[model samples]
Target chain A: MTLTHEPSGSTAVTSPPVVRRRRALTPTRVLAGMVRVAVAVLIIGAALFPLAWMAIAGFKSKQEVVRTPFQFFPEVWRLENYRTILDDPAFVRTLAITGLGAVLFTLLSLTVNSFAAYAFARLDFHFKRALWVVVISTMFIPGMTILLTSFIVVTKLHMLDTLAVLILPGAAAAVHVFFIRQFYLNIPRSLEEAAMIDGCGKFEIFVKLFVPLSKPPFVVVGITSFLVFWNAYVWPVMTITSPDLYQVQQYLATFRSERSSELAMLMAGSTLAAAPVIVLFLIFQRQIIANIKMAGLK
Target chain B: MSTTVTSPPRSADGTPLRAHPPRDDRIAFLMLAPVLILLSIFVIVPTIYAIYLSFFNWSFYQDSEFVGLRNFTNALTDPEFRAAIRRGVLFVLMTLPIQLLLSFLIASFVTGVGKRLGTALKISVYIPTIISAVITSITFALIYEYSGGLLNAVVGLVGIEDQAWIGDVRLALPAIAVPAIWMGLGLMTLIMIAAMLDVPESFYEAAELEGANWWQRTLYITIPQMKNVLLYLLITGFVAAIQQYELPLVMTGGGPLDSTTLPNLFIFNHFRGDTYQGYSIAAALLLFLVLGAISALIFRVLSSEKLVD
Candidate 1:
């Protein structure tokens, strides 16, 4: 009887009008959106500032660069800076070396890592799990930790000054293998079984069936491997002593080391060096992001 | 290679073979031969050789002598070596947290903004990552240079006197760290953003039903869900921070009284310098051991928490 208050409680059900009054844009939501916009702008700005500065400075005269109150845009853009950097014999040679090295490294690594990954993913053998564990474990070993040893090995093999030293040591990245293996694991095994029923050996099955289905992972590996090989400095700097053998990054390092005062030329060289990688990134941004996600999931 | 050819086995259905072809281990060996040989020659064997060389008193110009722990003893006791470790650790401390935090914040924001804008922002963030570190270091060097540098110009507009960012020992390491953090921020941010995006939208929807605001959603849902990615970034960042070399090498030359000298640079200098090959090997070994220990700790923590996923 005490709980029979439905007649008065019926008013509580008619609260839509009051709730509608409270549905306007609140100061809190507006502030939050504004804050998000500001942060986004700031982060993007900070990320692009150096690249923009470098690009602009590449066109500025040496005197104009160091003058007080820097100019964001050059008054007289020096087209000669680009011409000068491009025409430099050493610069051209370094670019060729870097280009060839990156292409070769990518091709070799893609083949090796993909095959190894296929074997690990599909094959049944003794110590298979243990071997996979060993391979993946190498991912955690920092490259610098093996620098001296790598150098010694390269020296002993008489590959010290060759691009082979740069390309060969990085041929078997455990992470790349793990990445490709994970992708391979997700493929339907029925395709491989069908190939086997058709008398296609493992190698033929991998080539005819698996490789055709795995273009995305291949592109991811190719682009990433190219980027890693292209940007490599420490190993190249350590192993390569001659100017002709230097990769793009090593060449840039030497350029900066020698001509600390030549701001225009340095900036020009920096722009050229950055162009290839930036272009590659623009082309494969989606694949790169996907690969990064896959890497994390592993 | 022919061993597999000699061994015979029944088929899966246990049929007697009419024509048993030689089992070719060659293909299996062929599949793995290149990588195995390369790894042994380049990685495994060299590692063994480095361990062997660490026990000697060798010189680059002359034959090495077996010194038996002398180099390690010296490295353990040397003030310069200790100072290098201290500086290396300091460099890691200076760069890692800032890089991780900035990357995380940018990632969170970019992911929060859905679709086209997020994609654009992610692309922009990743551009610097693809650019070589040497280029970034040189760009920053230009910015930090005393004369008409961008940094000085900015500081001047703020009504402060210009200072030599990379020339002064006190500021050199941090100045170098700035470029490193900048270069690293992009990749990590893109990575974390991708990871954050993978956190199912249903989590946020559920949290919203619980009256969770953006901050609460990020804290209770996003961060917890993306712990593995964060941990990956942290561990990798820490390792990468310690391995810092190219920036200091190109920008500062480990200069201004060795204020910016890292362990890798120390090893490189030892190798290139006169008559210290043995010492260099020992130092490199010690550095490897330290790196191994740190990696082991990370592996242990990650495994214990099952955070690698």
Candidate 2:
């Protein structure tokens, strides 16, 4: 983290992946080889530094974090910070609330979005044009711009501080519908025709054929949706007034004010908020990259 | 493609296929009704509600008289609102170009490397993307602390003094942009990588055959070919930048004298205050119109960045 990842751009020369392994590692290539190694090292270190720093800071004592002549390594490696966060009912409840909200929002939103996507992509319907216009028109309105009014609307609907306020308002994204519809539209009509010939109804065809086939796009959209719902802060801040309803970010928002001097604990809370998503990302890395390739290349 | 619903097959084969069923309007409607209701409640109604409420001099749950376009005029003239908009634009300036450049370079470098190292770098860069903005802010808060923070420790290695990153006006906005850029870096890099790969290895090989250095190759060929994705990213990233609320809220709470207060955070603060609810809603609507216009322009310039054709 001492350096940004710019100088590593020296790998600038051989950046196309296909050509990366094609070069020979011979004596003639010493300078180029050294540069490549430098690039690799810098990219890894620079990218991981902030996260690594946060993780490490969790191990330091409160005083050690702000200790004079700042030490890079903590004097003591503490596990108590993690334990402390997990033990706090407020913190743990934030995790549970956020986890449940994200999963349910993902499933609910994807189902509805895919339903809408299928309708636009494969089926002909009355009001299709009008409905598509309605969804697509609001596609780019930044949620921040609507925060107060969304509060007013949800309050008017009597949903403020309820769990439904968290999940339902954001469950039907126009962008998701658009993304999934783009995917659905790309599936060959012959597959749908064959399914139709087998006497399957439109709904059945969507469930069996389209749903299964759309996995790659679903993975991409699903992971993103989960992250969006999990990381959601602005709306939750406006609506969830009760401490019990705090999402992960909601808790993080209050961290400085609630436990001001506990740097280690703050770091622990940040790590807890971040770690699960990192694990999810690592497990899904190959799929995320692969599906993106499929989406882009196909 | 819509013709698939009614028109006959494009190719004739020996395969026997029955005629397609009539249009599935009822089935489609059944499927779409739930989301439509949700969308109407959340997206549509809030938007229209915001517009309607913008005209009134109403406070929280208060029955008040309509004030015509006074709120709009007042918001436009309000020094804080104007300053916040300026800061939002300033942030976009500070963040976007660096993000575009760094992500582009990192994207090229990471994707170019061997499998083991590439995977390592890829995961590391993208880690920040998944972390919530609030958590990112919380992490960076400690890092940007005036005394004995991580950033100062790093800077001290080069003999710079300990700096009040988010506390000082000059550094506060830039300080917030750091985490913003870091969080967005991975996704943009991933996007850039995909676009770079789509440029075809033939283009790079041809440049290499002509004795162009890698820097020149990237500058002349790689950058040019990826313009559409870059432009798409720039525009969308701009919109995202302007909407930044979390960092300022969690980090500096609008910073020393509102230097870091972005337009959204400005609205959010007014939203908390009991008196200016109507004006906040009006300001929100105006911002909405501007963003909606930019988004429309983006959609028109490039199809919707599935980066669609």
Task: Give the clashing residue pairs of candidate 1, or none.
Answer: A66-B148
DockQ computed for model 1 against the true two-chain complex using alpha carbons: 0.25
For model 2, the chain A TM-score is: 0.89
The estimated TM-scores of all candidates read 0.87, 0.90
Please identify model 1 stretches exceeding 4 Å from their true place.
Answer: A1-35, A126-130, A294-298, B1-24, B296-309
Encode model 1's per-residue lDDT on A1-298: one tens digit a residue.
Answer: 0000111222222111111123567899789778877877887888888988888888988778767666667899888788898999999999898999999999999999888878777764444555566666666555655667777678878998887888999888776776677677777788788878989988898899889977767877888789889889888878888888988888887777688677788898889888888888788776556455424242
Clash tally, candidates in order: 1, 0
Q: After superposition, how far is residue A265 of candidate 2 from its true place, in Å?
A: 1.1
Candidate 1 CAPRI category: acceptable
Give the per-residue lDDT digits (tens) of candidate 1, residues B189-213.
Answer: 7667656766777787788789999
